[model samples]
Target chain A: MIETDQLTRCYGHLTAVDALSIRVEPGQVLGLLGPNGAGKSTAMRMIAGFLIPTSGTARVCGYDVAREPLKAKRALGYLPEGAPSYGEMTVREFLQFIVRMRGLKADAAYRRFDEVVQRLQLEDVLGLCIDTLSKGLRRRVGLAQAILHDPPVLMLDEPTDGLDPNQKHAVRQLIDTMARERTILISTHLLEEVHALCNRVVIIARGKLLADATPAELEQRSRYHGAVSFSAPGSGMSQEMLGRLPQVASIEVDPLDGRITVFPKVGERILEPVERLLREQGLEVSEIQLERGRLDEVFRQITTQETDGARDAVAGVNA
Target chain B: MSPIAAVMRRELRSYFVTPVAYVFLVIFLVLAGTLTFYAGDFYEREQADLQPFFVMHPWLYLILVPAITMRMWAEEAKGGTLELLLTLPLTLWQAMLGKFLAAWLFIGLALGLTFPIWITVDYLGAPDNGVIAAGYLGSWLMAGTFIAIGACLSALTRSQVVAFILTALVCVLLILAGQPQVLDFFQGALPRKLVHAIAHLSMLQHFDAISRGVLDVRDLLYFLISMIGWLIAGVLLLDLKRTR
Candidate 1:
């Protein structure tokens, strides 16, 4: 439903988005992840037809954003970074204005309006001016406007930024439900949100695409992938002895709890081997488990490595 | 509804929802009343014509029109709603025209409310109603010209104060171009034809021709072309900003 062909946007000496390309299929929720100044918003703006890409092209539902802006915009709804709206307008007034601008028929517009108002729970504040609403409420109002016309594609930048926990959950739920019928591209810094909501994740840094894959696939790149952990009562097996095992690459002992974590060599099956070793070594094992890697750990590794590389590049220039 | 109409409706509703519409109405009516009766000396002249009233419109609008239009695009840029509006399915020209018509209609409403002055003139003596009607048309055209320039300036920055001051300054120059002192500045330094060209560009000169019931096509074309020129410049400026 959305595609970009080497989308590039440069501001003088700094490139905001650099030769970035992406494709989002229908019914896919794509979580765009990056650190500060990572070109996430710039890419989304180009897709939404608000900003012209310095080179290449962005297309939504088969229409080029620059060539056929109106058509591309018709197929997409965008919630910008701050969720700006007409402060003087009431929530209902603002939504209705959008509906009219979208060119919906009267009956269809009002019905859709009522549906979004109820869905976003904006009934009580319908008559209040937008500026008078709290941050969470204002975010919900922004959500309501984006979903009001029920466009087939959605580009949301920080949709859950200011919401309280419950409101954030509500918005995530709404996005989850809407993903069944639309293509969603959401940019956020929250790793957990990406895990919980996105089927596909794309990580970028310094205007370059760094990683793109499923959440599980990205997690597999972590150092802790397929590691094993067990808490035992004073296992007499020394760290050196365990390190001798062919499958066991490293082991960590928690001093206070006397628990041991075993990391396997790449492509090695250590769970069975470690269990057999512990059984033969006279260790009283209370708990043992195999684990998938943590997404947060992998996220930090990937993003920080990129930052360090950027710093090194700057340092190299100085040298 | 068309794109322009939709935008105009929203813009008009926004005007009333804030204090801008009410405050503007009050100030405009008071100024018009005071200027006509006190400064223009309408009753002392003892003529049924509304010459005193119509003559003050350009100067009144020099300040007031910019006040109304300074926020037209500047507020959108500041509040970040310009992104939302542009990303909608409307063309740039459609949005600009919509906003322009909305402000133009608002100025028309303010001009319309001064009907009591027209009634007062009718009651006192036999005034030439044709000339009065022509004067109103002329005033509305001049309002459009001022709004177009203000709209262009508003697109240059996000600060409404800056937009207001700059628009007022430009309109002052445009209105003062025909004054004797201004023409005198060029009298010896430039040729007679060049001075005439400068005077012809003055909004006051064209408006005076129209208000006196001489509805020349040249004056009409002058207002229309200038209005379109400024609006096109405003739209281009907005597009330039979006590229960044």
Candidate 2:
């Protein structure tokens, strides 16, 4: 539903968003994962037609953002960061205003307004002033305004930023449910958020996307960090000896129970190799299991974000 | 155009949606009434016209117009919703004209409330209602000029303070352009042709003509061109910064 072609935005000398192109499909939640200053928000802004790219261009629903912004914007609903809204207005007033701007019929507008307020549980606050509400409540109202028109594409920047845990859960659920009919591109630093709701992850660091894949697939792709752990008799096999064994890359002694933990790199079957090595060495293995990298672990590793190499690689891929 | 009107409705509604309109009207009425009866020396001078009341408009608008427009696009930018508005299927001109016309209509409403003064003038004596009407047109047109400057300045910064000061400064220059002291200052600096061209651009020259019961097309075009010029500048600034 949205596509960028070598999109680069420079704020004077600072390249806020490098030549990074990404495509989000309909009925999918694409999480734009990146650290602070990673240009994820900038990318989302450009696609939303709020910020023009310094070079290249973006399109929404087949309309070029620079050349035909109105056409593209017709298919877009943008939830900008900071959630700045007309605070003096009531929740209902704000949504109705947006509905009117979208040119929705009065009856249809109110119905859509009611639907959003009900779905986001904003009915109680509909009559309340936006400035009086807490941050979480305010965010709910902001999100409500965004989806009032039911646009085909949504570009949400830090959608769940200030919400409480329950609100976050509800918001994520609403986003996930809404993703069934709309294309969504979310820019957030939270990996759990992406894992829980996003169908595709775009990991960007320093204005580049490092990894873009499914939750499980990203974990599997970074499978080099898998490890096996088991308890063995200390009388025969020492943890030091296990580390020296072939295919057992390294061994760590569990301080509490003295169990041996082993990590093996690629081309090594961790479980079988550890089990055989322990038995041959006269050690009675009590328990054995292999643990691949968790999603969070892979996220931290892949988006470790040190040098510009990976950012360049991702930018190259996007281009 | 419907979208533009829709935006205008909301923008105009925003002024009245809060206490802004009521407060603005009260302030305008109290100031206008005070200028008419006491400070303007209207009763003592025994003039059966609204000359004293409208004489303060160009100065009043230097402060009031910015109050209305300082938050126009700057607030949207600061709030991060400029992206949402820009991405909407409205052209740059639509948004600009929508916002400008909304403010213009609002200034018109505030100008409308001065009808009591017109009524008061008729009550006391047989005032020339035609000249009074011309005066009203002239004041509203000048308000448009101030609003255009305000609209342009508002787009340059997110802070209302900057917008206010810059708009007031620019409006002051426009007002002072044809003043005797200003003319003397410029006469030594440039040739007569340039001075005449600059004098024609002076708000005092055109607005004073209409205030004296002359609704010349030249004066009307001055206000419209100035309005469109600043509106265009506002549109360009907004279009440049259009993004999420």
Candidate 3:
């Protein structure tokens, strides 16, 4: 329900968000991943109808953000970075204000207020002023305000930034539940959040889209995909010996954890053969599992490559 | 509710919840009382009119109105709530007018609380209630003019202190443009029509004409037009920042 066509934003000589286009369909959760200054938030701001795009168009539910802002804004709910809120207002008051600003009727506003409060578990701090609440509580309040209206399109920037582990999980669950019928585009630096909450991931760096795919698809890009990792009690299997096993391309032994991770050659299955080898050697395996590769590894690979390429271009100019 | 009313309610609620409204009311009332009795010499003049009280309004508003409006948009920008506010389905005019009306009503409340002074004048002598009524109306319009200027200035910066200082300086210059002391310097050097135009632009001059029970449509239009002009300018600035 969200689409941007060659959307660009420039501040003086710096292009904060370059010519970019992205589409988020209904019932799909998109994880927008990028490092600092990747223009993720800027792109979100433009789509939310807050910042005007320097060129091109951002449309929500078929309404142009620049032309029919009110209609486009009506379809979207945005949680900006830092979850900034009016500190003087109580949590309840703030949510109520948001409900009204969203143009809900009194009965509908109150009903939605109760629903979001219950969903976010904000009952405890309902009457407390926002400034006096803890960071996590404040973030929840901010979240409650954004989703109170239950807009069709939700753009959340770091929705779980300051929350504790439990709170983060709860918010992820909330987003998951909401994702059943709406379009959600969340930008976060936490790679695990993409795996946990997003079905589709869009990776951007230096104001350009580098990769966009499913979490599983991105994970498959890692060399560690289909690797087998097992921990044994002081097993005498050296890295070289483990590497000699059929289909085992490489092996690594963690000195601290005593885990042996064996990477298979492309298009090979090493788990069955490795298990057979361990059985033949009479070594006790404490734990063993197959991994789909680490998302963090792929994230690092994509973002760093962009930076390195930029550096090489700079060097080429200098030469 | 309409978007304007919705925003107005929120802004008004925030005003009272913080210390800004109370502090502004106390300071404004204290200064009004002080200026009326000490500086304007109300008791020494022994006049049955509220001329002394009416005369000090433009000056009082020049300083205090900025205090009331300095944080209107500055705090929104600083705290990042401007994003939340602007991204809503409301138009820019709705939000700007909502905030401006909230501040104007707050100043009106502060002005309304000075009823005891009117009562005192009534108890002491047979004063012209019509003139006093006109003074209140004129004072309210002048206060709104200052508030609109302050709102425009507040939108230009993210610093409340800067908003207050710049608004006060602008108000001072506008008032001084018509002051006898300042106008005398230009009287002999400038053309007559140009001097008259400059003096006519002063908000203080329009307020004086109205407070004297003249009730001129031109003076009322001036205040209304200036208020709308400044608020429009504030909205334009916000629009500029949005694109940037």
Local accuracy by lDDT, each model: 0.92, 0.81, 0.91
Model 3's CAPRI class is high
Residue pairs clashing in model 2 are A50-B242, A50-B243, A50-B244, A51-B243, A51-B244, A70-B89
lDDT of 1 by residue, A1-319 (tens): 9999999999998999999999999999999999888999999988998889999999999999998899999999899988999989988889889988999999988888999999999999999999999999998998888888899999899999989989989999999999997999999999879977999999998888889999999878877788888887756555567789998888988888877889999999788888888888877788898877788788788888988998999999999
Candidate closer to the true structure by DockQ (higher is better), 2 or 3:
3
Model 2 interface root-mean-square deviation: 2.9
**DockQ of candidate 1 against the true complex:** 0.82
Better of 2 and 3 by TM-score: 3
Arranged by TM-score, best first:
3, 1, 2
Regions more than 4 Å wrong, model 1? A230-245, A253-260, A272-289
CA error at residue A243 for candidate 3, angstroms = 2.1
User: For residues A162-235, could you state the per-residue lDDT of candidate 3 as single tens digits?
Assistant: 99999999999999999988999999999889989999999998889999899999999998899999988867
* TM-score of chain B taken alone, every candidate: 0.98, 0.95, 0.97
How displaced is residue B182 in candidate 2, in Å?
1.1
* A34: Cα error in model 2, Å: 1.2
lDDT of 1 by residue, B1-244 (tens): 8889999999999889889999999999999999999999999999999999999999899989999999999999999899889999999899999999999999999999999999999999999999999999999999999999999999999999999999999999999999999999999999999999999999999999999999999999999999999999999999999887
Off by over 4 Å in 2: A223-226, A229-247, A253-261, A265-290, A305-319
- At residue B160, candidate 1 shows an lDDT of 99
Cα lDDT of model 2 by residue, B1-244, tens digit: 2778977887888888778778878888788788777778989989898888878888778777878888887887677666667666677787777888899999899899878888888999999888889999998989888888888888888888888889889999999898888888889899999988888889988988898898899889998999889888877877666532
Model 2 residue A142 CA deviation in Å: 2.0
Q: How displaced is residue A158 in candidate 3, in Å? A: 0.7
Mind giving the per-residue lDDT tens digits that candidate 3 earns over B114-187?
99899988998889999999999999998998999999999999999999999999999988889888889889
User: Could you tell me which 10 consecutive residues in candidate 2 chain B have the lowest summed lDDT?
Assistant: B235-244
